[model samples]
Target: MKMKISCKPIAAAAALLLGGCMVGPDYHRPQVNVPATYSELPGWTQAQPADADAPKGAWWTGFNDPLLNELEPQVAVSNQTVAQDYANYQEALAEVKVARSALFPTIGVTGSGTRQRASAGSTSSSFTRSVGSGAQIVNSGSLEGNVSWDLDLWGSVRRTIEENSATAQASEATLANATLSEQIALATAVIDLRTSDANIDLLQATVKAYEHFLEVVSNQDKYGTVAPSDVVTARTQLENARASLIALGIARAQNAHAIAVLVGKNPEELNIPHSAAMPTLPTVPVGVPSTILQRRPDIATAERQMAAENATIGIAVAAYYPTVSLSALDGFTQSPLGGLLHVANYVWSLGGSATETIFDGGERSGEVAAAKANYQAAVANYRGTVLTAFEDVENDLSGLRILAEQADALDTAVRDATHGTEIAFNEYQAGTVDYTTVATAQATQLADQQTALSVQQSRLLDAASLIGDLGGGWSDSQLHDPRNPDKPPAQPAAASAASAPAAQTSSATGQGAQPAVQ
Candidate 1:
């Protein structure tokens, strides 16, 4: 018997599969309401293109603190949180390759050898049928190769690839966000440590002044020129001053420990010597609110998450279509172990099959609806992230503006209080006033000085926070796609346009339009 097979039907089906329609909504970034300008921008200094002193490289360098500059860079490399995010990003990148592998065919090879003993009288079809009753040995060998492909006629594999790629980009943005946050934390800790040092110096000076006042009061009490209560009051004031100076050590040590951890070190490993220098407050440039969309890494992370969720909808919609699969097998088989590769023993087959679900109890519909709802949620989250970024920037700007005015007032009050304290002490020595007046004046001077130092610390803290809220020199354009990590990342506008739903309509060759990446 001879069998004849026709390839025309399979070829025609392949053409139809290639030109099949991908039934689902393509991804488009949802519209968002963005403000034209920030409400707190009025008092902030706007950066000019030609300003030579504007912060150029790392924003932390603008503070001009040698220790901060040295420590801040280490956060990106050594901070445990940042290292964990980086590892997650690498895993996401590998997942993209895993998803893309579904787009191509799978190839496999198999080889086998078999030997068996069979009774000769079992089923004889030879010329001398039913002549022999003894057992016979048979040897057989086979080798085969197969190729199978689950054709992506409805763009399911393409959608899966798109989803994984977007996830990878989101993970990359997450890594950036983590690094920026740790760096900001490091800068803030250093500022606190320096403020503690400054406070310690101020308190030490006040303690010395209090001791001198105590000495003068004790001498007068011994000569009967002052009341015995005056000696008690003087000793009480000096002891209180000493106690306040000792309390400052707690804050300074805690701040140092926090800085060490921020830079990925143990508290005991890093020893920060007492520095007389304070960090200079840097002028953070406030741009229009729209710029935050591109500058903030958290916003970028949210946007990429939206794109990934959008692709999931397409994947779910694909399940509604029938699945088509193509397969091919080629090999040689022989009854004996000799000449297995001969043309007489060659065998080949080409086949294709399609399966359509007749009944699924509405499972497919539920999946599609769930995917769409998830995408909508992602869109809402993205918009919320953007709104929150604007809020952060506005709050930082307002705090800095008001704190600057308060700093000036405190400076003037400190000088006047110092002069008042000197006059009160002289009046007490000349017997024109009681020792109580001297004690009150000294307390006022110390209070005013401490308030001034506190105001300075607040201003420096606000500067660091403002810089961080401004994105700490990060940009969305730095988010690299895993597929082409060496190439520059596409701009947000261009990437959105490329993956727009309107542009996706024309592609049906199982090669859907993809998100833009350089």
Candidate 2:
């Protein structure tokens, strides 16, 4: 009958072990819209899904610029912004370790020593004691250890660990996003500087042509063949051209300073030499629109946040159930040091307790409600982020297309303007046109040349922006996922713009080439 009574507690423990199920809803990837092919990508073949397994392509190399190759890698190593994100990732990694510790029992030790004397007249439990040497000296010592464990019968600890792991994964995505942002920024700044250099070159050449025109005008005035005002107009045009040429230095200097800061150098520490050849625009082969979710860090971040929020629901639900606590104590005591290790002095005990929240004024209910609301919000945010990413890629594709057409038309205008300038100069020599006419033609030619150069600059900038909009080669896999990597297999080249169908694309895979610019 006593054995039958003891079996009851064992039956309860068995029930607890078998009945455990995580209380909250398990995470499932939220449904969101993903387009078939980019509306802006006309006449281009979409890469098959198998292509995503190809190496993540190097988009910057598509530009074919040597200088960019040298500068872009520096942002990862020395840039302060990237460094800050790296440190943040490390902190998240540490937090994962912290959350995991709850799964194990905790141990503590205690020790004490004491000395005392008992009165000679004392009695033991009302029984008379004979006086021995007037008083008896006594000494005692102890060493003890205790163990306690909060059994995860309700899955609270498991839920907490899941929450932390998801949060850490989100942090990893943020770091990748920051690092990519800075790299693209540095690349854009360099493009701007190169553009400025090209424009300055154009203006300087105009200045030289204006100087020659001024010489011809002065000779005519000396011979009294043209009026004094004619000489004054040519002199003004030459001076204006020189002023414009010199003013461009300000922009060039400032852009150089900006590049210096990006690479973690002082403003004056770096200098880029003038190069006439701009990097060739790589045809950015924007594969299909569906893959963008795999490579985008911001999107990855949002999805992870949703996952983290989902775990909190389980944690809140667990709070409504009882918590099981188990503890054990073991110690040794002796009057003399020699007897401390003997089993005769051993002391031990084991016990288990359970606590239930019978009433809490609806606090637990409110908490559960709040957790659900937060999860819903995260889902909305994740969907919104996906939409925004698709829009970004589309914008870049459209921009590059239009800019290319504009560049061709401007090239024709510059050539016609040059012809007009030559004809006006020949008319002046024949004395059929005044110096003012030649000056006007010269200004028109300079203006057209400047416009053409600016278009070239614009084309380069749009290309760089396209690369940025496409995710700059970052993968979702780079983040820490101890139990399972959330992202897809490494993206094929140019997949920095990659996204997975099931929210499993890595943030750091796919070093393959990007979409080609048409």
Candidate 3:
């Protein structure tokens, strides 16, 4: 003979799985009102299109500074902020795994062995009568296994996993943002240090020139060709130049401290040589503005956060439906230890249960409202980030253009000062002008040279700032780039090369077409 089993449970599970649909509005990228072209302004040149296929990783390498290219990776590997974000990303991934596991059944095993004496009038005494004993001692042992599952009839488990997976992606973006930030900081700090050093050199040369002038005045005073008061005035000018040199050292030290922090080292452990390592500004290609949405890690992070929030709305809505659970157990039991193992001693049970929240003083409604509010907040934040990113790129563009013009003007000033000094020296040698006139002209010449150096440094810094604001040419490849989270690692050579702007053009601008985030 054959026994028949019902297929009702299997059919029901299949129906639930097939019928379930996630509830919530699917994510839609917000439509932003962007300009066709950046507004024309004084001293501003239009940005040119960059090559789409060119590598945009390790943008700092475009400066062609071997030391900076070497140090950039170290900042990404060991920077404390990047490490924290990397750990958070791992934790989010683990949460996704945990959430995904909820779609399956849970199984547990239990076993017990016991010996007991029964009283004469106890319920077990009736069964003992068949064994011919007034009072009986029983030995019992049993092993049981149970299975429980909550069928995702409404896709609750699937929705939960969806929410967590989006969170994990957001965490990954955050890590990339942190890495990009560290790289930018290190590059900018290095630029600042170099600029400071150049300024110091300029001031040192000025101080030496002033010292020589002071000596000339003192010698002339002894010969009565110059007054004693003139000698004092010259000494005072020399002291002022020395003071300026001392002040420049203070800024340089501070910049060095900042660089140490960027590289994840103690200030005392860092020692940059006094070489003229000023970075050369690269001709950056302006990709489309729409690429900023995909290229900037922070913007990507904001977009992912919106996706997670959207999923949360579904999770909250799921709470309004009834929860169904199925449980089953199978085992054996008997009065004697040996009998418990017999085939006839088998016992089994299966059941289903459900629970619904009929009333909770409006608590469920309130919870749903809160979830909706959270979703709205996330949307607003994402939009705000998009706007801010646009502003930063535009501001940097204007700064670079205006500074270039200023640098040109300063170069002219240096040329004129050099010519004036030559003319003054010739007149003084012919006794047509006094030594005081030549001294004044020489001082003017020194000031103009110093100003020119300062302007050039500013221009370099402005260029670095522009690159940093544009995300340092960080590419999507480095989004998953495996740098040691615990310590800074060197950027790859391929990334460095790819980061260079494709073509040198004065009329280039970031591209205007937007890319999809998902």
Candidate 3 lDDT over 118-175, as tens digits, reads 6555535223433346666666677777777887877777777777877877888888
Per-residue C-alpha lDDT of model 2 across residues 304-344, encoded as one tens digit per residue: 99999999999999999989888777888766444665778
Highest lDDT, which number? 1
For candidate 1, the lDDT comes to 0.78
- Each model's lDDT: 0.78, 0.74, 0.69
Off by over 4 Å in 3: 1-19, 40-55, 115-138, 422-451, 475-518
Poorest stretch of ten by lDDT in candidate 1: 497-506
Off-target runs (Cα >4 Å) in candidate 1 are 1-21, 43-53, 120-137, 490-518
User: Top TM-score: which candidate number?
Assistant: 1
In order of appearance, the predictions have TM-scores of 0.87, 0.84, 0.82
Would you list the clashing residue pairs of candidate 1? none
Q: Which scores better on TM-score, 2 or 3?
A: 2
**Decreasing lDDT order of the candidates:** 1, 2, 3
Every model's Cα RMSD, please?
10.5, 7.3, 7.0
